[model samples]
Target: MDDRVAGALSLPEDWPAHPDLSLALNRMGSFDWDLDSGLMHLDRPALDVFDLRPEEYNDRPADLGQRVPEDEGARLDTMLVQALEAGQESYGAYFRCRLRDGSLRWTHTQGFIRRDADGRPRRILGIVRDASQELADSVARQELDEERRRRTSLVQATSAALAHARTVQDVIDVLKNSRGLAHLGAANIVMGLLEAGRIHLVAEGPEGSFVPGTRYTKVDERYPMSEVLRTLTPRFIETPDDFARSYPELWGQISHLGVTSAAYLPLIAQAHPIGALGLLYDDRAVFAGDERNLLVSLSSSIAQSLQRAMLYEQEHDLAEGLQQAMLPRRIPEVPGAQVAVRYRSARLGRDIGGDWYDVIPLPGGRVGAVIGDVQGHDTHAAAVMGQLRIVLRAYAAEGHSPATVMARASVFLQELDTDRFATCIYAEADLTTGVMQMVRAGHMEPLVRDPDGSCHKLFVEGGLPLGLSAEFGSLDYPVSTVELDPGHTLVFYTDGLVELPDTDLDGGMRLLTEMVRNGPQDIRRLADQLCESVDGYGGEDDVAVLLLRRDAVPSPQPGGRLRQHVAQNDPEALSSARHMIRAAVRAWGAGERADEIELTADELITNALLHTDGGAIVTIRILAGGERRLRVDVEDRSSALPRRRDAGDAGVSGRGLMLVDRLADVWGVESRGGGKCVWSEFLIPERFERPGRHEPPAHHELPDRRDRGGRDRGGRDRGGRGGAGRERPGGDGAPREP
Candidate 1:
């Protein structure tokens, strides 16, 4: 007998059992216990039954507790309490406990009590026995009972993987990592995909176990495992010797790979075998019945995981690629501005993020910029982002204000079929006026970094995200303005970069401020730095940033600035006629064009001021083409036309129009808005001769001066003859002198 077992069988020195009682106790494996104090006095038979020593039971519950199952600790404590209270004359328990060798055995324990006349328990007796072997048999049966359940789950998972996997390669990958469905040997695992009817080896596990990229022909293959897949049943190759005996020609190939046994399970999809799972074993161990059952069960699960990932990947690629292509190829140059941007996803899943930015040129020398984030991370989100981008650009091009654009955009986005929401900031800046207009949806306030390196947020009140309010209120989003001083920077971004998990909004804003503070000055450099920093801060969503710097103003010099002429309505071939004024400016020189153009424009206005009624307003614009040339336009609000009299008979007033017609390169007039405007231009003298320079004759200095007075005089006679041309202020009289 083992010495430990013998010692445990020994009796205590003081309460040694008598020969007769020892025989009885050994036969019955009986013991006595005082539950209140947790004392156990076990007979040698009972102690030996649990492989415990006599001294271990001396007021010690540890010995019995050692046998209690970890999961049953609470139940056993309650049982002990009931026994101590004498609630029942007898009690019983059954549980697993550890033995002397650290092996566990299930024991069935029963106790009986001897009570006094008052029915109070005085003494308790118990019996214990080793039930380890019996319990093992019970567990084995229970495992068998659960086999059907596990198989069902595995099949369902595999079916799902198969249904979702779109590509052949993805199908194989899905099967590879499908866990818990089979007792697959993690070692020597390889996957072969069927592409274009050819078996191409796609993946293998246990690095270097099999030559990668190896291909094998499916035709004329004597693979019982592969053959069995056609029937959708698990195929088994019990042993290499058996395979050799059954198919000698193919035995050498299997033996060379040290294949001693194998099983091929069919990966079925929609009642068809899309592929076969070939599991190879290099040892001679026969496939255990349970393991084969487990493998078959798990095959379906592996198939399903593969299917899901593949489908997701396909949609992700298409949606994400299209979204990126729709984005601007590069930031445009706003000569005086700096720009930066960053984008990322909050989740690991496919196409879940839809964030975008755009810079557009607006009328009246302004630039429009927008940054918006879509609410989801899938193809739908990306699609919506693309749509919104297109709509915003078109609306801006149509000359809508930032606030109007956002207001209309919300309606457009809400009408989309997809369930996507967005937050955005729309801003426009008039470079000529230094005026900036901005409207924000429910988005993080943009950061403004002044030239002094001080950063502040552009927080506007009364804004909400798009797609939330059914009847989007007039994008009452406050439009804020700030002077975009030269060298100062404005940054717009999606909230993703600043939003940390569970952090307060203010804290996130502060962190973003710090990031911008530490960022580089150059737009591109700042963009890259912000991306890296936000990622480091554990940014959970896609981060997008757009930075703008107002460029320094260009110095004013000849040919550097645009020039314009303003004029007014006319009568009798109005001296400030629109066409004539435009033609004159076109012929005039670019240098000092501003002064010359303004004077010519003022003369036309003075004539109209002296002639027309109802407050005539006229404007002329000189569209400069180059350093020496320009095009001109003039407009006025008078319907009554201008008149011209003979230059020889003209007075100071008539001389003004004749002098203008003679000096300007060209002059004319046409009806405008609700009236007519006449205009003319005078060339700026290039070089004025000194007082005693002995200048050339007037006729030689200026070629005939166009002789246009005769044409105007004739036009006045014709207007007087008919009623076609409206009369001037002094139409019936001769010319007025200034």
Candidate 2:
């Protein structure tokens, strides 16, 4: 109520609220330092600036050390010295000064130098003020700028990551796992895609906080996600009570999660809401000012990515359907063998591949298993695979030999109008005799698992891939034969099953071998387990697996036969034939005559290789009559007739006829086209004849050596040499002189 006396300008009682009184309200003070006396004089406000009481003050600047930190005081002295030396009229600085409670307060000072003629001879006058509020405002501005930069960085990182998302799951993975989303300050993320008039919740927040029936709700429903979608607007939630009041359905279920705030954004692409995105925060208030705009922009980006991913999935599904149709519809039940087949599509990208498998039943209880992959991963590769599979199956079913089938398939693929090539492995197995001949075309080696659960790689010499071999004129695929023992499993697969990123084929093969060894004993279960392992790896390539397990079959009796191709001068081939004879004679129930059968077969094989032009095929079989008999036949390309030869103890060669005649019960020679067969037979012991199988038809013909057709080509038999076990191959013909 007081009024000022006459200068006649009257101010209200609250004078500090006036704009002109701002300078006084700033808490400013002044001081005078007399350099000559090294003493300072301060006003009442100046003592207050230093937080010093009147009784604690002296007329000296050094006494202010109790108020100003030592470092800050030195800084002020340095500023003064520089001002005086530079002949400056003014100087200023801001520093921290201590208060009576021993806490720091920001202070500012500006000084004017009064100098004499020499400039060094001077006194200083300065002002000091409390600057805590002013500087605190500046610090606040810096913090806001930092937050802005972080948001900008997050947006850029999220956009870059979403650029590579080619599938819907990929987009979800980025949102849940990417570093950008992790730094968004969101505790968890939720997402829902709109399909068929409903919101399908694809991603949920936290462990299990998803509301019960709210997962798939209609657009008109009273839920936050539904509200955002229905209005095509962004919903920014401020606090826990605000959330609970607005959307009690969602809040009740999620309140236990400590979610105080949230943002539900309408994911709109092309003016339509395709999905909704929800960001959950715990114990925080979110989406103020530009933050709401940031969420909207983020939702837009997510919408575009989701749309693109869905489109990719649609196109990929169509291509993958074509791939499945091209693969074998179903593996046929094969006699004498159990078959399991599987094909998995590529998971990383939208492209479909040409990995495939097939099971073909051949005539005469034989079966063919095939595994192959075309060159590229696309619709074109799948098309080529379909055509190639058809042609390969046709050729195999045409009674072609394993090598012939592969060679013809290679030629056929090259002749096709496409530029694709395929790597493949084909196996032709005669279950009756436990003999399988394999042909490889630049494919991965097959793995054979024994009955005891140990596995090893079976390396067959191979030519170039189908199309490439024909182009390069190297179409001679080697036919490597393996005798499948009862309960042994032959594993055929494409490279995709073993190949992994950054790993070599050798390492991959080792891992695959271990997996096969440890897999379940049942072939079907094992096949599923193998595909499951590949699935868990998230492999980039498509895979196909074919397992043919020979069921436990009785030993070969009258129809039992083993065939092999022995190249000229191939010592290894001669030795393998001998070992087979020994194991076969023992397994055929000839206990005392195993050695005689093996030795006689060795002499005939040695004679054929030593005298033939190229190589010979050896066939050993059990012939049923009044007595069980084991015979050996060596058929070479050459038809030269073989006769008895003499060799004394000193002679290193010959004596083949003497060995054959002495060991065999009956020995003879028969002439056939392109070859002559020298044969001998030995009477197997009575106990060796098997029940229900000892009698074969009178015209029962053995499969030919090369084409493997049922034919009675003249057979040359070798009598017993000391050998043992039912065992397992050859061309039939006469013995030749060495």
Residue-level lDDT of model 2, residues 362-429, one tens digit each, is 76456889999999989889999999999999998886767778889888889996889999999877
Residue range 388-505, candidate 1, lDDT tens digits: 9989889988876565688788888888855677988888764433346677888777778877778987765447887764355544445554455677788888877777776777
Query: How many residue pairs in model 2 have overlapping backbones?
Result: 40
Clashes of 1: 51
When superposed on Cα atoms, how far off is each prediction in RMSD?
13.4, 8.8
Query: Candidate 2, which ten residues in sequence have the lowest lDDT sum?
Result: 720-729
Question: Global lDDT of each model?
Answer: 0.61, 0.78
Ten contiguous residues minimizing lDDT sum, candidate 1: 556-565
